[model samples]
Target: MPITEVFKEEMGIGGVLGLLWFQRSWPKYSCQFIEMCLMVTADHGPAVSGAHNTIISARAGKDLVSSLSSGLLTFGDWFGGALDAAAKMFSKAFDSGIISMEFVNKMKKEGKLIMGIGHRVKSINNPDMRVEILKDCQTAFPRHLAARLFTGSGEDHHFKEAKSYPECERFHWRRICGHA
Candidate 1:
């Protein structure tokens, strides 16, 4: 039933109660599932091409929406479009009912980078270990893990980088030894 009809039928206090009940019991609805997905996406903060571009532009002082639009422009394949291509390769591989070395080679030949293989900052062998945090969160809150994991991972990445500097090391040691 449409929301208008439901409200019209319920009316006044009844309508208010009904809306409150719906909102309070929302987790039982399919809409809640979609809300979870949206939360996950939002938590990622547009790490992809267009989103990153927008973030960079915003850092340089573009207004909110226009900066985001600038970032969205980079989402297209011609810029750094590998997500769809990688997904297609995975689908083809899975549908073929085989996981042979030949199949892997075929994906490589087709320019698939084996999702989550490389970090723009981390070296080829030392990929980020943020997956461990997600794994831990999964046992507690599986539905919300992905969204929260993205945020936590970004923070962990920055923290690790910050601590890598000699200045950060000195500051940390001085504070720990009560030299500050």
Candidate 2:
């Protein structure tokens, strides 16, 4: 088969992100969700570490490639590194059958700080609008239906087992983003 034909067969026209498009059975909103995620995380502002580093490097007469590399290098533990830690922590807690309150208690007891649970300016009363936008999109999408179904008895054994955790119901991305 021709490479183009093979590409079409395997990935379809919108298969630039293999993971998102891997399953032909995915809901239509799946692509939209991926896009929303990308949009939200694309950039915070020039004050952020990566952008600041890039600006500094450029002002120092660095080339575009070097400046970009310097910016990316700033994305370690102190900068834009909390997402991976948060994902792992949440996954571990969920897999271990821990509730949200219990997880919070354990982290507190261990003197471990939750990575994605605070913002410099946003508070519970005044949440970030970007998070609100993403939450609204999620609610409108069919994936919200799937999330609901996943909270109950579903054919997906993993989800079915996970439904027992009350945290799963309350744990929205908005909450996490707002917490930070």
Cα lDDT computed for each candidate against the true fold: 0.51, 0.62
What does candidate 2's lDDT look like per residue over 108-180, in tens digits?
A: 9997877677863577888877888876874564434344544554333454466533344344322322331
**What is the alpha-carbon lDDT of model 1 when measured against the actual structure?**
0.51
Best-fitting candidate, scored by TM-score = 2
1-180: candidate 1 lDDT, tens digit per residue: 466865565444433333454432112222333344444445445446676788788989999998988976676554445566667767887898867587778767987556534543455477544555434433333322222333543233443454433343344323333354
List clashing residue pairs in candidate 2: 117-179, 118-179, 118-180, 119-180
The estimated TM-scores of all candidates read 0.30, 0.33
In candidate 2 the C-alpha lDDT for residue 31 amounts to 44
Worst 10 residues of 2 by lDDT: 171-180
Structural RMSD, model 1:
21.3
Off by over 4 Å in 2: 1-15, 19-25, 45-127, 143-180
Model 1 misplacement above 4 A: 1-53, 56-70, 100-102, 108-180
**Model 1: which ten-residue window has the lowest total lDDT?**
23-32
Q: How many backbone clashes does candidate 2 have?
A: 4
- Candidate 2 TM-score versus the reference: 0.33
